[model samples]
Target: MNAGFDVAVVGSGIVGLGAALAAHRRGLRVVVIERGSEASGASVRNFGHLCFTPQAGLARDFALTSRELWLGLALDAGVWLRESGTLVAARRDDEFAVLRDLAATRGVEVELLTAAEAEARMPLAPGTAVGGAFLPRDLQANPRQAVAALAAHLEREGVEFRRRTTVGAVRPGRVETSRGPIDVGRVIVAVNHDIDLLYPEVAERHGIVRCSLDMMRVAAELRMPLAAPLLTGWSLVRYGAFSATPAAAALRERLHSERPDLAALDLNQMYTRLPDGTLIVGDTHSRGATVAPFQAEFAFESMLDETRVLFGVDALRVVERWQGVYASGPDDFLIEEVEPGVHLASATTGIGMTTGLGLAEHVVAAFSDDVTTTADEPGFASAPTTTLQKGAS
Candidate 1:
């Protein structure tokens, strides 16, 4: 079956969908091939926190571009999106220092809050925060709703979706699938961690691994509704903008020394309240070539305990528990040209929700002659192909 298309996206995940959207916008015949009937991957399993303010370097550039696309989706695709900026509660002096330092560098983008102000804005325990910061540029979406809505919107926009079809291989101008091979002008591989399965050499060359996360949703009574997606000191050490601060080193030391157990779990204590008011609490990271299906109960318990302490709640009714995985690599992204006319794209860290769309847009624009490059657009001047090399220090 030669259903010729100008572009073929190899996954229905956020990045893949973004590629399809970009190609479709350029008047290219686009087809999305998915192994499952729907998107059921890290795209849905995340906190839906679009923390764009904390990104640095190339990730920050992509985040800025993605922000515009996301806002457009809200108006065009009817995707549920909130302009609610990210809130960071700093319980300790070191945590406050990290926020303070970032504020100094970022100026209006990072607004520091007093203890009282922090408590009033965020649903933290009355006096749990010594200080905090609000990142006005961030956003929140319902992970369960966003991707599905985006997929639906793309389908309505004349993009062809071939769901329940497994992609066996991708060559220069063809995508071999479970159903049959399709002729494509270009191929965009955005399968996240599954890149290892489809293109083992590319995955290995980029030092890609699976980073599994433990997360849960619970119904809980709060001091007040969370003003936005909330981050804790545990988060300060993870994000590029916060972690790169001079004060972050001391903060990291204090956190690890105080709670080795949480450190061992690789915690990024954060919360996002869904529209239904259930709280999404997570998460802990563990990375390897392969992740264990058995999630440790202790990791969940630790998260629950931290949540109870942070919110000053005694009880929480557990709604769901699950594991989410993404592609983890040494760099912030994996953009490569495995072969001519076939591009590989993946957010190597947990920033896919923040940067995936822009990454896909840039990748597609690199090959599309119709797409014009703009001076203001970040990462659009040149294709990011072959940037991540194997064993490059």
Candidate 2:
């Protein structure tokens, strides 16, 4: 095996791949090491929503930068990217109020439309939507395909990848892997929910926890061209920019009163259509480093029940069900130097797809200095309290 490189990335998720790209761009010999044969974690399990409209502060900046990177890669790497913005359906007066408040406060390009208008623009059940907001900047892609394309692109560009290789230990100038030890100049471990395996002390001290969510995919009744991803009243309160609005408290109260069951599971309904005429819907959030092996049937039931009410559809043909877990910490992401040349970068929240690219750039930059010790690097200190909010938003 080629054990020599200027930089070694210890995971193949979006953040890891992004770091490898950043290092290669700086003329560094970079190699990505992955325990799995392919990218099979949160990066592939997400909704693939490269959404920035709902982000605020530093997260918004990162999302914008990542969006540019995604677009360029989609074109250059032949990855499928759908220019689908988000259409949030407001089924009640309170939800509409929250959307209006968000539109006014967040200076993004948003359009307010009547129930009829929203239904006409997107395929929703009749009279189900009272009104909605159309955010035009959001985009979508197939998470599974995007990650594969990205890794493939890196390989073609001279970056090396050692799959099915686990890192046993990380130190200043060498990585002890399951296969063997490799000499490396710098090491960045971007492992997502499994950071404890490599740096338990760092993960625990940073207050990092795992956030698990339920997701489902179903067959569409017909081949309908979905102009954008569809969201519901729950989503109005799920996203940060919308939930932070003064009107959000009232909306949440209404939801709790009207549909306590959905509130219990943290259920939020949003659907995106695949090219094969299937709809991907889901998700409920539960926080813990270790989740139960079993999935609750009620979670899926709540999602489907809400989908029926919002879309006014009689039934949704359930196809497949699964779960995704990501690391969640005190901030948008946790970046700290655990050793002199080893840095740990993990997006503790769910916006890995939205901000992973830009975060990787910052991670690589931290190693750009001439100093040998991490203490010499200015940005190697503890991570900042991210201004971006975490949750469904």
Best by TM-score: 1
Model 1 stretches with alpha carbons more than 4 Å out? 106-108, 373-393
How do the predictions measure up, each by TM-score?
0.94, 0.91
As a whole number from 0 to 100, the lDDT of residue 181 in candidate 2 is 90
lDDT of 2 by residue, 1-393 (tens): 865899999999999998887787667999899999998999999888877888766666667767777777877677789878888878788989988897788367788999788778877767777888899888898898999998998999899999999889899999998889989999999998899888888888888888889999986563236677887777777666777888999989988888888888787678888777778898898888797768989898888877666566776799889998889776777877778888887777788998888777767766775212244322222222244344334
In Å, residue 351's CA in model 1 sits off its true spot by 0.9
lDDT of 1 by residue, 186-299 (tens): 999999999999989888988999999999999999989987999999999998888988999999998999899999999999999999999999999999999999998999
Give me the candidate number with maximum lDDT: 1
